[model samples]
Target: MSLGKGNFQFFGGSKTLYELKQNMATIGQQLQKTEGELSQKAIDPTASMEDIQAAQKSRDDLKMRFDLIKEQHDQMEAEQKAKFAAKDNIQNIADPNEQVMKAKAELIKATIRQQPIPADVKQILGDRNNTGGEKLLPTTMSDQLLMEPLVKNPLRDISTFTNLMNLEVPKIAFQLDDDDFIADTETAKEMEVTGDVVKFGRNKFKVFAPVSETVLRGTNVNLVQSVERALESGLAAKEKKVAFTKSPKSDEEHMSFYQTGSTAIKVVEGANIYEAIVNALADLHEDYRENARIVMNYADYTKVVSFLNNGNSTYFAAPPETVWGKTVKFIDAATDPIVGDFSYSHFNYDLDVLFERDKNVRTGIEDFVLTAYVDHQIKLKSAFRIAKVIDTP
Candidate 1:
């Protein structure tokens, strides 16, 4: 969540976390709305004092229930931050081997977090109640620039917190041996094709069936006490509690994704993170990618860089944050040598910079991004945690 400084300063590391907080605001609003509705019902005009008090008691109980759940969500968020911080801290060791260790740790955490998506969950997620939990981009561009995706599935956001609900996200089962060891049901069921093809001289038609059971692969299951050991597994083990204070981006101005602006960084879906990062660096280095069609500020993108660090491959930019005249992306490799660098992502700028920048806090070029241009954002993710029950299963 913290950018230590320098190159890390320009990296999306910090901006991403801020946007996450932005997404959290919506959840908070929902909570407050629920509170207001409850209060209205409790203080109904014709209610007796006894009835009002009873309703008030019910409200209090509801508040506690939300608070309890909120606490858990807060804990999960804190743990996520801690895990990120730890990975970054380790990466800062300045040792290539240590850096690998940390990246490996991060990768493991990502994999472990993914472990919760049990096959059966595909069924649970399809439930009607659960469908509301997902959001989609506006039917149209929703605004001037094409800054939205066709889907609003929160789980796909690369910068958002790992979804903890319904993914079968692992939880503590209990501790044993006086906390010397811990237990969890963090197991996964993966289907694989293993039967022999039995192609005998191109003769005979044969049928094959996949086994329903799983072969035990190591789970991230670990004892709850060791931080270093936990990192060795594919899941984040760091746990903590966090209190989120409301955060709003600055009134820096605005630009839509693919609109004329000085700071907008158009992004397409399926863009590779690594590739986007390099391109952003290169774009800044080369100054601007091209002259803007509506606004003429793209000329300022003229800052040219000699090369990407560690190689002669100077990062390049594709004009208007575009490539081959298309706005959507399917891969990092598709970017022009110079065009793939800009990113308005979690690691970069966020939505409030466009919608509510008048109040949100910002750092780096994002100050320019909100004030200068509209970005073409093709990916969307929310920053909150909640569960949607289906059929009371």
Candidate 2:
């Protein structure tokens, strides 16, 4: 099967895909070993015919299994391409509103079966052009995908999001040393401002949602909503993971808060978690402290609660809505408590998501692939601070 940039074909779910690939590799190795054994047995002067036949059969069976897997993988790719082509036909619709719902329903039905794009739908989308069959999601659909993640992730509420189309964005920072009133006619002094450019579009991410045949084939199911919900959940989780964790590879561009070389504030000696958080807030620059909010894992919040309640099991207090006079956000991806004005952290992505479909013939499951180009930058490092607590004996 041919794989292109942003277009990957895999059989079954991600884990199953890995296992399938490993199985193929093992079978190929065994086939090669059997071939060597067969050659040796065939040439042996004292070897029996039965021994030679057994060796040959072993090699043949291994080869057959390997070939069968390859065939299935190729078939799945072909089916995906066909479905994509059918989906593209829906773009011809002139009215944007009509196109959105019509295309959604047609695509969902096409995913369940290999039927052709409806004649009316095809006519509405118009003829295919010379764009190599690549198309962006409609405006309404794009908005839905963009807003859906906010519902799934609390981090989205605190951070700034921009639909950036350019490769680089220039950030200007100005510091005015004098704002005092002077004589009305007095000349104002010019102040020097600093500016820097941050490049974007360096990070690429993909999210996949696999649907079982049973769910897709259900007559009473709202297929469109079902597929959308799965995609939304997958995208939300992947985005949060990327935003909070550092990339394993040093060479790759990572917008994670835990980027290497980032400065972290240590918890003061003899301070509790709540006090540590308060100290972290005090450490932030005064200009950013007013807008600062706190983010940490829920588990860490539970530890704070335990400390507050003196570890009493019967007298549990409800989780605090605010910590240190700032809104507290919980994300499982957060490893340490971060106190900062997250508005300075910008997350940017293309307004469109490329959608593709693939089916695992053996398992009767289909995976919806959503590919997006995204990049993020913390415009001002000093605007945020991470708290690290150290235990002492």
Question: What TM-score would each prediction reach against the true structure?
Answer: 0.18, 0.61
lDDT of each: 0.28, 0.64
Worst 10 residues of 1 by lDDT: 236-245
Q: Identify the candidate with maximal TM-score.
A: 2
Give lDDT tens digits, candidate 1, residues 151-226: 2212113222221112221122233455323221111110012111111111111111111112112221221112
Go through the candidates in order and give the C-alpha RMSD of each one to the true structure.
Answer: 34.1, 20.2
lDDT of 1: 0.28
Give the Cα-based TM-score of candidate 2 against the true structure. 0.61
**Model 2, span 1-393: residue lDDT tens:** 223323333323343444666767877898899999999998998999999988888887777777866666566667778888776655655667656556666755664465544545444434242353554443444557765443477778888776656656544244245554322111112111222466666456666667676756654235556677777787677668767776644433356777765222223322656767777888765767889988888888877777776756532444455435788998988887888888877777776556667776787778766677767676656677777675766
